[model samples]
Target: MGYAQVNGVRLYYEVSGSGRPLVLLHGGFGSTESFAALRPALLARRRLVAVDLPGHGRTADADRPLRYETMADDVAALVGQLDLGETDLLGYSLGGAVALRLAIQHPRLLRRLVLVSTPFRRRGWYPAVLAAMAAQDERTGERMRGTPAHETYARIAPRPQDWPRLWARSGELMRREYDWSAEVAALTVPTLLVFADADSIPVGHAAEFFGLLGGGHRDGGWDGADRPASRLAVLPGLTHYDILDAPALPAAVLPFLTHPVREPT
Candidate 1:
């Protein structure tokens, strides 16, 4: 566990196990602890570099707002600082957005990308989820007191008093408008899109996201030789909130990261 000075912010990250590195990013309001339950299986086969994104966990928020693009740049800088060369990148929720941007904006740094519960566009989230994000403000922190997100922040943040600010900034970032279909369609890195059957976004949107990666448009031939380089997995019996804790997360991830690409005969 250590800190890397990158993009004008001190980013905290923890490295565990041993093998090829897989940078793990957590959802908004979450920390490295977000994947605590899911890391064991992954650790056995791959090194886990779990990052505490800016304004989350040990890292404090900077003067700037918490925009996904800026956060992506921060992560890219962290990769450069660590000299990780080409490595796998995985992000959940907010971290997923950052991971998406980095893979699009700095593809050279990554060998593969895994995005869990991520939406390509803002409208990809259900209307109710959008309303919840839009409702967040400084006062939201008070309402969130004692909740897991709040409790974790209070326990580890450099300044627990900054919860309200973090809440507001995260809300602001989420509420902003965005659509990256063009960029997604242009992606070259092998990608995996994971979502729950009952995710924050519709299953159809998940299909849409996979489509952007050139998946699901055709049937995989016998032996799966006719599929796109990218893949999708919609795990059963889960939701956006609890998907991280599900063992199925690492279960779906390991094969994608470890399996070699097969060319059509």
Candidate 2:
């Protein structure tokens, strides 16, 4: 457990276990500790490098605005600094956005990727989810006071007083709009999109995103030959907030990351 100076932020990350490295990036308002439920399974299989993004977790915020592209660059810098060749990456929610950006901006850096409850486009989130997006402002931070995410931030953050700034900035970042449909279709890295059956994004968008990755388009022959390198997983009876903690999450994810996908010659 140490810090890597990446893109002007003292990025805090931890490495554990043995075997192929799998970098874990958490969702918004969360830190490396967010993976507590899923950690054992992931650590048992791969070298886990769980990191706290710029503002969340143990890492302190930089003077720059919170943006996925820069956050992705921070992760890229960390990966390069560690010299983790062809590593696997997994990100949830906000982390997923950063991971997706990293995969797009630096495809050669990843062998495989697992995106948990993430969307390629801002509209991918449900309308109600977008409603909550617009609802954020200065007062929004106080509204989050005493909540679990806020409480967690208050405990581990380098500057606990940054809680309000964190919330306001998170809202600002979430409010920014961009779409990567064309870029996603051009992505070469294998990815697994994991979404809860009852997620913040409409279930149909999952299929749409999967399709962009060249999945859900064709049938495998009798020998199961027509499958795409990328895959999709929808865990039952779970929502966006709880999907990462579900036992079935690793069940659906690990195999895709651990084994080789059969790419046709």
Candidate 3:
């Protein structure tokens, strides 16, 4: 376990292995432990840096509401603190949004990027669900359960006292919005997009995200030919949460992380 202070917030992180740096960003309502199952395989060939974003895990609560851009800045600050000028980035769900923000705001800080189960647009249903959960938290003062985000909270943040803050942070992120499509299109770093076949965020939306990139047109789908160096892989039979436990996910991703990106023909 290690720690870095970014923007007056104490961020908890862990480092393992020794090679090119690879930073892992867990989704909203999740902590650094979200990557526990995948870290070993990743660490075998790269130095892994997994962090507890503000208001999650062992990190302290934020003074203000959580926003993707602010979270991105926090990540950039951590990169600078470690002196890892240009490193590979892997983010899951909401964390992926943060990763996208980082690529937009500080492109030079990242060499490669990987996003899993991320949504490009804020859905209409999200805010109501988040608000209901926050209201429940405030009324009963008991943490909610059964949701994918809640499951992550249960696993990563076991302490009872930490629940409300995590819940609040999760709500804050859900309510915040950003225009990531245009920003993503401007990115130059090699990127890999992965989503579960049955993910709540439609696979077609992921396809749209891939199209918005510099190398491809939104009209044409990913045909493999004329595909950008950036690629998208939909893991079959997996849902929003299943990707976390999928047995074959690491194998599917490892190759892409190590394989050098080819220039568009």
Per-residue lDDT tens digits for candidate 3, residues 1-265, read 7778888777888888999899999876678878878887888889999888887777767687778888899989999999987899999987888888888899889888888887666751245544653454332335355555556665665364667656556665565555566777777787888888877677677878877764446433465444577878889988878696676667767787797676544
Model 2, 1-265: lDDT tens per residue? 9999987899999999999899999998999989999989888789999999998989999999999999999999999999888899999999999999999998889999999999999999999999798678668888889999988898999999888888789889989899999999998888999999999988899999999999888996787678888999998999999998999999998899878797523
Off by over 4 Å in 1: 262-265
Ranking by lDDT: 2, 1, 3
lDDT (tens digit, per residue) of candidate 1 on 1-265: 9999888899999989988899999999999999989888898998889999999999988888888898899999988887888999999999999999999889889889999999999999999999999988999977888998889999999999999888898888888999999999998899989999999999999999999888888888998878889899999999999999998998899999999854212
In angstroms, give how far residue 118 of model 3 lies from its true place.
0.7
Q: Please tell me which model should have the higher TM-score, number 2 or number 3.
A: 2
lDDT of 1: 0.91
lDDT (0 to 1) per candidate: 0.91, 0.92, 0.76
